[model samples]
Target: MNKHDFKMGFILLLTLCIMPARAADINAGKSKAAVCAGCHGSAGVSNNPMWPTLAGQSSAYLEKQLKNFKAGLRENSTMSAIAKDLSDADMQNLAAYFASLPGKSAGGDAAFAAKGKEKAAMCMGCHGQELKGNGQFPKLAGQHPDYLAKQLHDFKSGERKSGQMNAISKTLSDDDIKALAEYLGAL
Candidate 1:
């Protein structure tokens, strides 16, 4: 090969070696996630109405939340403490394992769901037409109404801060929050 071609090949090889590989291991994630089974369930679904289900959530979203908790950007007593000890790879693995599972429906009140559908129109821009989530947005469908409502309340009250959520939640009343939660959870 010419000297120029040899130099280019060497540079490419060096660049490839310097870059970090980000492939997550699902089995490793499952092993690491055993501690989460108490609340998040063995399959990433939560039976309790208060805890949000992790199943089928986007890996990117899950990883971000874990990072947020670890950094204190998001606050949860249990999660923060747990996340504090996790490495970035641990978070990625856990997110991958959970995202690989199937999500379950929490069901909803018909009347409340009807009202919620109207409000969800504005949410589609970020959350997707089906509310299954986009890049970092979470899947609202099949989530628990109580958990969804609490998040909305937190956003409205400034307990949880998100540029979009905080502003949008401010426009909602208690009943609106409930209706939205019911509608989203049933999907």
Candidate 2:
């Protein structure tokens, strides 16, 4: 290459190296999240337990779910429509925005927590020992109890289909599900 071309190439490479692989613009995300405020609240914490609080969730996990909803891998009628038009960058930005917000905490039953601890052992393999997930696995700690119960129900009923989750959840009773939710939500 010519000297000028070599210089430009080196500069480009240096710039790329310094840039994050999925650089999200938080300002842009705030603007893009306007529509989400209805269900997810202005700060990404949904008042309705059924809707789930996205605040303080791992960015990678949030991004993956958005993509999955768009792709129809995870079927949610409302989420699918909302996510349909989101670009990869938009999803990344939204994820980052939500992840930047604060999370919530819930109360737990001591009796249920004891029972749920045994059940939660299975989740540790993927969700980490503390239930603070990494990458694609969601952080279950401090989530909504009703949301967790509904998700377990959905997994069991095939409304939300995951081969592993379906298999694991199908065996759980209503009490087990409730206990698990109570335990995890309290953390």
Candidate 3:
């Protein structure tokens, strides 16, 4: 290559190497997230029953889901529409913005938490005190109660396949799922 071309290529490589891997403008995400506010919440958490609370979800995981929605790998009408128009940079920025936000608990009902706490004791070893799941285990704290319940049911019925959760969930009854979902929402 010519000297000028070589120098330009080197500069481009250097810029790509030095740029922050997760640098995304939250402001841009805010604008892009407007439609998402209906389900994911203006802040990324959701009050919607079927929709999952995206707050505190792993950025990598959220990015994957967003792409999944767009690709039709995940089935959600609203979410798929939202994802369809997103560019890679838009998805990245959205992930960064949501990941950077603080996670909020919906504040569990005292009665449900009291009952769920008992159930939570059984879960604490892996799920932690606040039910905020660690690596690979999705955070249960403040997750949508309906979504959690559906997952539990899916696990029980083999609708959802997870070698990890399938075994653990086989033991959970419908009642257990209800209690756990209630408790998790409170956290």
Candidate 4:
């Protein structure tokens, strides 16, 4: 082989060797997700308004959030502790399992949802037209209204930092946040 060909082949082999070999295992994820059932249901849904449902959320988004919590980029009393012990593979598996489940809606007030829809136009760019989410944006549709509102409040207060969300949340009034949450949750 030519010198250049040999060099290229070595680089490719090294790159492949450095990459992870295992794909995410949904069954393993389900087993690991047992601890989460208390708050995020066994099926990745949630009964309490205080907790956000994990079902049907983007796997990328779920993985990113778990990493964030582990790295201290995101702060939550419960999640931080839970994420601390998780390995990268564990996070990936959990994200995959949750994303595989179907999402449920908790219908909202028509008047509030109507008002919120208009305000949510700005969110469509990243969150998608149906608010189903794209890549790392997260599925806002069908989330608990209270959970959504709390996240918005945190973003506004700078407790949870996101360049776009922090700026957009700052522009929202209390009523606007409520309406937006109600609207998104109903979907």
User: Total backbone clashes of model 2?
Assistant: 0
Q: Candidate 2, 26: how far from true, in Å?
A: 1.7
- Please, what are the lDDT tens digits per residue for candidate 2 over residues 86-170? 9999999999999998887755677887788779988999898998776788989888888999999999999998899999999
Model 4, poorest ten-residue lDDT window? 106-115
In candidate 4, which residue pairs get closer than 3 Å at backbone N, Cα or C atoms, i.e. clash?
none
**lDDT of candidate 1 at residue 149, scale 0 to 100:** 99
lDDT of 2: 0.89
In terms of lDDT, the best-performing candidate is: 1
Q: Residue by residue across 1-187, what tens digits does model 4's lDDT show?
A: 9999999999999999999877899998999999999999989899999998999999999999999999999999799999999999999999999999999996777789888999999999999999998999999999999999999999999989999999999999999999999999999
Q: Clashes per prediction?
A: 0, 0, 1, 0
Candidate models: Cα lDDT each: 0.95, 0.89, 0.76, 0.94
| RMSD of every prediction | 3.5, 3.3, 4.1, 2.8
TM-score of each: 0.91, 0.85, 0.74, 0.91
